[model samples]
Target: MDIVEFLSERISEDEAVARTLLGDRTVSKSGAWYEQRLLLECEAKRRLIRIVESARQAALAAMVSTPDQDVGWIPQSLQWMEQSLNALALPYYDHPDFDQDWFRT
Candidate 1:
């Protein structure tokens, strides 16, 4: 699968794992409930972090870079933006089938 599809699947799988972990969980005022809820919450949050990171990277990979004419040796804002984007660990950038590299190429 392509990076987008691969990441999308990962996100779906992660969401499923999160849902499973959080299934039927309820909270009360008891200390035991609080402690157990904390553990489950941590696990769910970790999975959520991964999903969010993947989505953010995909968005970054899809960003179009438009460099303006440079004056002297100083870089322009768009150039900086392009450089920052290129420096990111975007998995979508590695796939040959991904067509978002038209501007980067």
Candidate 2:
């Protein structure tokens, strides 16, 4: 499943529900507040979904420019690497950069 596509579908659904809930009604003050909140939440999801590709690219860049090694930072970089693989449906340790033994240092 493409995560971004899945999220986009969800956002569409949320927007539809919001419209239906607020469509024909004369909302009270609190109802108006909730309606605004719901629309904002949907907008937030859309903004986040728009950045999914940027995240994937950043993760791939991390794999390409890894440090020689980082005791503290390697774990976080690994998480980013893992996220890239997850999005692409690749194996966890499929990249040459993951092989410490292959490095001359």
Give the runs in model 1 whose Cα sits over 4 Å from its true position: 1-29, 64-105
TM-scores, one per candidate: 0.32, 0.53
Best candidate, lDDT = 2
List, residue by residue over 12-100, the lDDT tens digit for candidate 1.
55456545555545633464455556556546545654555565554444453323433333334334444433333243455454446
For candidate 1, the C-alpha RMSD (Å) to the true structure equals: 10.5
Model 1 Cα displacement at 14 (Å)? 21
List clashing residue pairs in candidate 2.
Answer: none
lDDT of 2 by residue, 1-105 (tens): 444454465567668887777875777778767877989988876765556566656666666687554445545765654454344322213443333322212
**Best candidate, TM-score:** 2
